[model samples]
Target chain A: MTLLTIVLLAVITFTTRYLFLHPSLPVKLGPKMVSFLNFSAPAVLTAIWVPIIFVHEGELNVNPLNPFVLSATIAVIISAKTKNIYWTVGVSLAVFVAMKFFL
Target chain B: MLTKKQATIKMIQKGIIDMLPLNLAVIPWGILCGSLAIQRDFTVLEALLMPMIVFAGAAQLVATELIAENAPLLTILFTVFIISSRHFLYGLALRQKLKVLPLKKRVALGFVLTDELFALSTDKKSLKGKLRLTYGVSAGFSFYFSWLFFNIVGIVAGAYLPDLTTLGLDFAIAVTFIALVIPTITSLPVLVAVCVSGVLSVVLKLMGWELDLVIASLVGMYSGYLTLRFTNQNQLNEPEK
Candidate 1:
């Protein structure tokens, strides 16, 4: 069962990646479609992070004391202020460790 | 004094070297994924196979989370499909550049395509024909190995260390993702898309929607598209104001 799950998931991932990559497919995305697809990165990132940061044990934990919330908030500020990925990840991780230590 | 083979090797080396810096992000992400898989009760063999077979960092992480919750197989498949759907866009974006390659080469390249690889490919000045192929393949291979290696490290570490979740290590994934998304929020439409998607996902999850991520992403994409259209029309209608 685990092997089946892994193989099927790989197939799905490969299919999406190969859908438009095939040389013989003759796929040409319209400008509107391109514009819509352009938002995929931010939209997907937001979708993934929201639950990770906001939810705890199937419940919404929005309090400021939530370590994930506080650390994530600091991560955002550091990310924006530095606009450097290394700093964003580094400083926020430090802040997260500090939060874990104190709270 | 360089032979043709030597020049090819040089280009491939350049590709790997250029990609090394991005490993900063990939390394941690891979380790976290490996550890998370183990924490979620994946056998070490299963954890290792996942990176080799699935080869997607974010999607694999999501899969581990869903598996921990014992979600239905169908739900896991559907959610992974939604998360990986973005790769379709990457393939679309690269179609023209890759069109000249043979079918076999195209398929091989597509198999290893990742967000970082795609970004690296597009961010460069044009390199035609064989050089492009060699460079891209080498870079992809470099990243692939680095990812797999770190997963092994994470698995070993997960085995020996105390539970990492207690140390808040899983939070690294969210931090990495936040770092990735922040630089992309350069315009109003993108900002709107992110905020809308973020809020909607939390709300949907709060409401017990298992597919909240998928739905929120689609809505966010549409909203961003609409915002851009509305902004364009307003500018057209009031060029003098």
Candidate 2:
């Protein structure tokens, strides 16, 4: 089962990973597609984050007092502001631990 | 001095460097997967080899669930097929980007074309044409190797990893997902797509549609795309009036 799982999934992932640009496939996915693909990244980000960043454990845990929430928010802002992913990640870790343990 | 060969080798090295962030995301996932596989009765060798061969987290999860349930082999095969539908889209996307490559290289690249590497490599406008062959292969191999390493780490640690959920490794996927989306949210149609995707996912979950996760994902992507096209056409027609 393990080997089967790995081989099958790897095959699928690899195929699609590079599937976008295959020739002779009638990729009528012209100008709008490029734009749509452009939009997908951030929109998908929102779809994933809003659920967690705004809510937690399936509840609305929106409060500055929530360390996990706070840390993540700070991290997002820092990431956006500085575009420094390393600091954003590091700061978030520190904030999450500090706020969760101490606060 | 073989300087160019060394430079070519750097291609793979560059892949490793770029994938560091991706590797962090892969760790807990690998660990969680490893632990789960063990609980389901996979031998150590089986557990370790799976991630090496398949290397995809979600597909592995779905496959494990099916196996544990003792679903018929056909049912297991179907589930695997459904879970793998994303790769078709992935392949479609890469088709034009890679046609110039010889068949063997394309097939080989296809082998290592996981989600992380594909998303990262395609966006490099600097890597158009056959040049992408080198870059993509390098990146693909790096991610594949990284996955193998961390997966082994996770499988070994799976015995010791208690309440793996508490480790909050999920956030790695969340963070990576967020990072993936940050580049795409520039328009209302796209925003609508995200909302649609989320609402559909939640609704499907509520409706007890166990397999709807990826289905909802496709719903979200294509619907959002059509909506964007519709609105654009409406705007164009409005000018003629």
Candidate 3:
């Protein structure tokens, strides 16, 4: 079953990727659909990350002192200001480590 | 003859330049995955294969983590399915740009349609017609090689590496999104859409929705869509502005 999971994951991912490559792969998209999918990039991401940040084991981590949360907020501000991934991650991770040490 | 080869090289360089900004974050995530796969008792072969096969850092991370927790196979499958559905939207956005390419090239390109590639390819308007396509292909394949090489690096070091997560690399993924979003977030509408989506995501979580992530995203998307539609209708009612 473990082997099957790995193999199935590989095949399925490759297929989705292949669908993107195959020009004749008729994208079932109409105008309305295209417009809707436009937001999928961010929308889908939000679905995955929000839970990780807010609820851990079904409890809100409202303690504004969590390293990861503080790091992410600082990261967002840095990213918004500079739009650079390297700096944003660098600053956030550094700040997080500092926070861990200090408080 | 020189112009032909030079043009191809130009396209490739443009593709690389476009991708470099995003790759900074992507690289660490790949490294973290490679390192973690080893920590979780994945053999060298499995460590190497996970990124190559799954081809997504986040999904693969989630999948491996779930597998470690003794989750049901069906649950793992469903989780991957949910995460991968993001590709459908990427496909939608690239439709017109890719409409004219032959199937063979499209398939080749599809294998590397990552968020990095998508972000790079979409923002580029320099290469028009045939030249544009060559540019796109170069971008996709460059990412492919980078991914392959990074996975091997991860697999090789899997045994000796400390906790990749403890190293605080996961934050890189979220930072990557912020980096990508900033460029496209120039307009008021786009700003509103992102804030609404992000805030609603937190709100939905507070409301105790188990699938708040998916629901919050849907709320953000719908809000953006309807706002656009309303603005368009109002414009139509008036003369061209």
Candidate 4:
């Protein structure tokens, strides 16, 4: 069952990716649509990350002591400043680990 | 002093070198995904094969989480499909440059076309024809290799190590998403879209929606689109006034 799911999922993903590769494909996205598509990455990623930080097991946990809030803030600052994924992940992971042990 | 063959090899090497910086970030995420797969009770072979076949970090992680929750197969497939739908935009943007390649090479390139690879290969001046193809191959394969290697290491480490989830390593997934998102919030539309989608996701989840992420993402994209349209209209009206 799992294998089937993976294969089916891969097929769907590959087909979507290959949608515009062929010239004969009739799908043409207008500039407005393209602009809309451009927001998909940020929108989807934010949606995924926000719940992970603010909600734990279906409950809101935005207190000061929530390790994720602090760690995510540090990660965002480092990522925004340095524009480097390595530093963002490293600093965030360290902060998270420290908070887990100490706080 | 380099022959023609050596020059081509040099181009490929440069492609790999260019991708090295991005791999620094990819490695940890790959490892985290691998460990999560083990925790989710995926077999060693299944975990190893996923990166090779799927090659999508965010989608693969989401799949593992869904599988662990015993979500329906259809739901898992749908979620991953939506998560990776952005690749279609990448493919469309690359169509002009890629049209010059033969069908076989185009298919090959399409299979491994990632965000990093697309960004690196899209430059018209630096890469052309055979060089572009070679660059794509080299960049794609190196990423593939390291991604798989780190995943294997993570699986092994997860097996021997205590519960990694307790260590808050799972939060690394969220961190990865943060790293991906923060760099892209440069404009008002994007900012509004992100905030709207994020808030909607939390609200929908609180309301016990089945697919809150997917719905929130679509609404967010639409909201961003509307904002872009409104801003463009305002700019046009200012020119007349």
Candidate 5:
């Protein structure tokens, strides 16, 4: 069952990726669809991270002392300011480690 | 100016080198995910093959967590599909730019398409010509191997260190996601979309919705689209100053 699930995962992911890129496929998207897709990446990413950052051990943890919140706050600011992944990740990880140590 | 072959080589090299920083960032999560999978009773071979085949760190992470809970196979597969469906948008975004390449190359490129590769290859300056294909594929291959390598290290180390999860290294995944998503909120509509989706996801999770992630994302996309249209309508309605 596990092996089957793993193989199916690969197939599903590859199909999602390959559908539009297939040279002979008749997949034509409208401009509105393209514009809407422009938001999917950010929206999907946000949805994924929010649960991890906000929920700890099945409870909501929104306090500043929460290491996830502090690190993510700094990460957001740095990512927006520098638009650099290295800085955003480096400093955020540093803050996360520091928070874990003190609190 | 360089010859065609020279340009191709240079672009491929650039792809490999350009992915170095992200590859580094991906290492911790990749290792952690490998360890998590192994801890979830995945055989060493299964842990290694998961990353190599799925090539999606985030989706694999989600899938493993569900597997740990002894979730149903259909549920796990559904969650992974929803998590990875974002790649559909990536394929659509790049199809035009990549259509110039032959069908075989296009298929290969699609197979390896990743968030990092999409970001790297879609930079405004490089979004042209066959060079994009060369660079995209090379970058994807580079990141893909690095991910698999990191997973191997994680699997080996996880075998000995049963408490790898206690180190709080999982926070790195959440933080990495923050860094990845923040820079992409380039406009007000995107901002609106992100906030709506994020808050809605939390709400749905709290309510114990079965497919909160998928539902939240669709709502978020719709909110963003509506915001864009609203902003445009406002501009059109405003009289010339």
Candidate 6:
């Protein structure tokens, strides 16, 4: 069953990516649709991250002592300022470890 | 101007070099995904083949998690499809340049069209004709190779290493997403969409919704679309003043 899921996912992913590459299927997405697609990255990524950070064991955990939330907050600030992945990952992991050991 | 052959070679080399930083950044996530696959009880072959076949880091991670939860096959497939829909935009952006290639080459390139490769190859100033094709292929395959290499290492090493889950390394994926999202929150519409989707996802998850991720993503997209439309209308009205 897992194998089948992986294969199906690969097929769908390849198809979506290859859809416009074919000359036979000329797709002309309008400006509105394009703009919507532009937002997909930010929207999807944020949605994915939020649950992981704020939710623990299927419940919301927003306490200040929660290491994940604290590290993520620091990481978000660093990422926004530096726009660099290395610093974001480094600082987040460091903070998470520090909080894990000390707090 | 350089000869065609020289230009093609230079472009390919440039593509490989340009992808280095992102490839480095992807290593930890790839390893994390690999380790998670092992923890999920996936066979060595299954874990190794995933990055090579799926070529999507986040989608693979999500699918692994869903599969481990014993979710139905259809649900897993649908979730991955939704997560990967962003590739459609990448395809759209490269359509004109890629159309000139033969069907076979186009298919091959499409399989490897990742976010980094697309960004590197679609520079309107640097890429043209055969050079564009070569450069994209070079970058795509380089990313593919590095991703597979690190994932394999993780899978193999995961067998010997202590339980990784206790270390909270899984949070790296969330951190990666934060890094990705921070740079993109430039416009009000984008900000609205991100915040709405993010908060809604947590709210729905707390409600015990089975498909909170998918529902949240769709709602977010809709909110962004509406924001864009509203802003455009306002701009048109302001022109009259």
In model 4 chain B, which range of ten residues has the least summed lDDT? B118-127
- lDDT per residue as tens, model 1, B77-156: 99899778767767776776776678888878888787767656643343357887888888887888898999888888
Question: What is the DockQ of the complex in model 1?
Answer: 0.59
Candidate 1 retains true contacts at a fraction of 0.74
lDDT (10s digit) by residue, model 2, range B156-220: 77777674645555666655555555444556677677777767655554555645555566677
Task: Compare candidates 2 and 5 on lDDT and give the better one.
Answer: 5
The positional error of residue A18 in candidate 3, measured at the CA in angstroms, is 4.3
Each candidate structure's TM-score, on Cα atoms with residue i matched to residue i, is 0.78, 0.76, 0.81, 0.74, 0.85, 0.76
Per-residue lDDT of candidate 6, residues A8-91 (tens digit): 878987887788778878576666666666666677667778998998887789986799999999999999999987899788
Q: State each model's CA lDDT, in order.
A: 0.79, 0.63, 0.69, 0.76, 0.80, 0.79
Segments in model 3 whose C-alpha atoms lie over 4 Å from true places = A18-28, A42-66, A82-90, A100-103, B68-71, B124-128, B203-214, B235-241
Q: Per-residue lDDT for B150 in model 6?
A: 88
What tens-digit string does per-residue lDDT give for candidate 4 at A1-103?
7877777767876776666787677766676665666677777667778887888878887786689988998998998898777788888888888988896
Best by DockQ: 5
Residue-level lDDT for B28 in candidate 5: 80
DockQ-based class of model 4: medium
Query: How many Å off is the CA of B101 in candidate 6?
Result: 4.7
Chain A alone, model 1, TM-score?
A: 0.82
lDDT of 6 at B22: 65
- Which sections of candidate 2 miss by over 4 Å? A1-71, A97-103, B1-7, B122-127, B163-166, B183-200, B210-241
Candidate 6's displacement at residue B111, Å, is: 1.7
Worst 10 residues of 1 chain A by lDDT: A21-30
Which sections of candidate 6 miss by over 4 Å?
A: A1-9, A19-27, B1-21, B35-43, B58-101, B114-136, B208-211, B238-241
After superposition, the stretches of candidate 5 with alpha carbons farther than 4 Å from their true spots are B62-76, B121-127, B166-168, B238-241
Q: Tens digit of lDDT per residue, candidate 3, span B109-131?
A: 77777766766654536324777
Candidate 1 lDDT, A1-103, residue by residue in tens: 7778888999999998888877678677777777776787788667878788998767889898788988899889988988777787788778877887886
lDDT score of residue A71 within candidate 1: 83
lDDT of 4 by residue, B133-217 (tens): 7877888778778888888888888676555444444577678768767887787888889889999989987887766877888
lDDT of 6: 0.79
